[model samples]
Target: MKELNFFKCKQVIENNNIHIWLINLEIYKKEINNLKAILNSDELSKSEAFYYRSDQERFIVGRAILRIVLSYYLDILPKDIVFYYNHYGKPYILTNTIDSLEFNITHSNEMLAIAIANRSVGIDIEYMYCGRNLEEYMESLFTTYLQKDLRMNTSEEKQKILLRLWTVLESYVKATGKGIRYPLSTDIRNIVNQHTKNLINSNFEISIDTCFLFKKIEIKDYICTCCILEPLDKFIIFRDEFILELPYYFEKIVR
Candidate 1:
């Protein structure tokens, strides 16, 4: 009876699902100056350290956007939110108003993805541009995603498949806060093999604490993966009346 109840409880959590906010950086370019002021001195210095102008802008914009998203739930000014880093260098914010809330961020080029859930979560997105040398790119992929016979798929199709797989691998490390030290050489091909047919509901093992779910989000020309530490059977993309400006405020989601 207890075990059955555990599954039932998980089902309830799944019904609530993950909340993701997709930020399109291009739309916010005109507000860069406004976003710049949202950063604290520490973040300003870090942003300045980036060599490229574009890189600096991304750091500032990404930080500001993350805070704005959190501000909605916290019912606070975005600039007042304080962030602390865990041992693995993942950033987290604390709010006495909310409990059991966890979030993660990932960005590639102009697209930024933020995922929030009731459990530890990590999110990753990759713009699928054909800039990588096919040979070198496939070398990094696990054997399970690679074809034994080179004739299995067209070059374009293969790149999409392998690149999508890459995001899943990345989501694991990010979700774990394992950082750069985690083995990038891990061949998830075999582990992911059993779960590929149902990408959104995929679950494979890395360890007891690694992940309870691996999910794919559909965004054209980009591959996105989200990993959650606790099983959630469903997810929702949050764009209901969202604005790139300051948060519109929201009720506290977690208790």
Candidate 2:
């Protein structure tokens, strides 16, 4: 994993065609001020600026991590990377460069992660103890088959397993840039298998070429998944170490 010094922050990882940027939100003091400047700028509408600024600190961390990771692939300044929202409201790259780097950003609690790859890629991370009744939430958010699978795997050993599945599904939807347009009620196994096969057969098609590779990573207490439209021989997972620095910042800022 390659660590970058861009933006004066540490703990950025890059391998093969993939880049993962992580940030522990607790450590950054200047982030809030920086985000406020962006929000207060005349470039954004009053309502839009106010909405984003309301959660400015979190979004600042997310965008900072995104800028650093993307800088490794694009020559543009981190703040200059223009973004456009898709029909489904997901943000996407709008550069004229031929790099074709696909990426996704996500944040939960104090941990924020971003993934960038040569093909369409999406990633997600959720805290293990987010105060949800797992069984009840699954029944409402997942398909009948998935609910049954969760029920059958009643052993305590499956908490991580359930999270793994959830992350993968979330990642797939994010990669497609569809968000919840493709609901979680769809069969998980079928989606993975079918998407992989479809990508292989339609590699020459423009749409398929936009998203062709997919992967998932599971770390202690965290589950993350990546989806791409291109084929991949193997994936290398790197658990970012920078999250350890966040608590220091949080202690100073939030308190």
Q: What's the TM-score of every candidate structure?
A: 0.77, 0.65
lDDT of candidate model 1 versus the reference: 0.66
Best by lDDT: 1
In the range 128-239, model 1's lDDT, one tens digit per residue, is 8946554465444434443453337678766766666667767877777775353443435444454433442334323323345677777777888887776564576754
What's the lDDT for all of these models?
A: 0.66, 0.54
Look at candidate 1 and tell me the lDDT of residue 37.
78
Off by over 4 Å in 2: 1-16, 34-55, 140-149, 152-159, 182-189, 192-214, 233-255
- Clashing pairs in model 2, backbone N/Cα/C closer than 3 A: 26-249, 26-250, 27-249, 211-229, 212-228, 212-229, 212-230, 213-228, 213-229, 213-230
- lDDT digits (tens) for residues 9-109 of candidate 2: 33222334565555565555344455334332333343345455435556655565566456545765566777678888787786665546677888776
TM-score of 1: 0.77
